[model samples]
Target: MGRFIALMILVIPAVIAGYGIKLMRDTIFTLLNTPYPNLSVQFIAGFILFLAGLGFIGGFIFHRDKKNGKIAPRFKRRK
Candidate 1:
């Protein structure tokens, strides 16, 4: 149950990241999405979304690694 919940939480960010990629690609191909007024807006929004999702996932993994002492010694909390 715990693992399932964790997976569900992760899925949302993954989907958001995927959609961001799609939006960026569309902008590059000159395909306009109605919700966005222009290519610049779409591209910017996509970039932000992609970074946000990536940051969240990266932070989660980093936290887990820190807890398990799997990361570099320099990153570990100092006593």
Candidate 2:
């Protein structure tokens, strides 16, 4: 099924990215000599990156109510 394959393709990367970020955060912070004490920064960075990846993947797989030609509005106008 085309839909199923597309859905899988989109989701699998997100899942892997999430897990990979977690692993990286733990490994990086678990060391003794490091500027970052806790993993808050790493966690947040990973979170943002993961969300970005999801957005990119979802742009195609997720459907939006489209009539003719329309575009989604940006959250904030660029200066």
Model 2, residue 26: C-alpha shift (Å): 1.2
In terms of lDDT, the best-performing candidate is: 1
lDDT of 1 by residue, 1-79 (tens): 9999889878888888888999999999999999999999999999988998888888888998888889998998799
lDDT of 2 by residue, 36-58 (tens): 45566556556676777777666
Q: Whole-model Cα lDDT per candidate?
A: 0.91, 0.61
**Model 2 steric clash pairs:** none
Off by over 4 Å in 1: none
On TM-score, the candidate that comes out on top is 1
Clashes (backbone N, CA, C under 3 Å), per candidate, total 0, 0
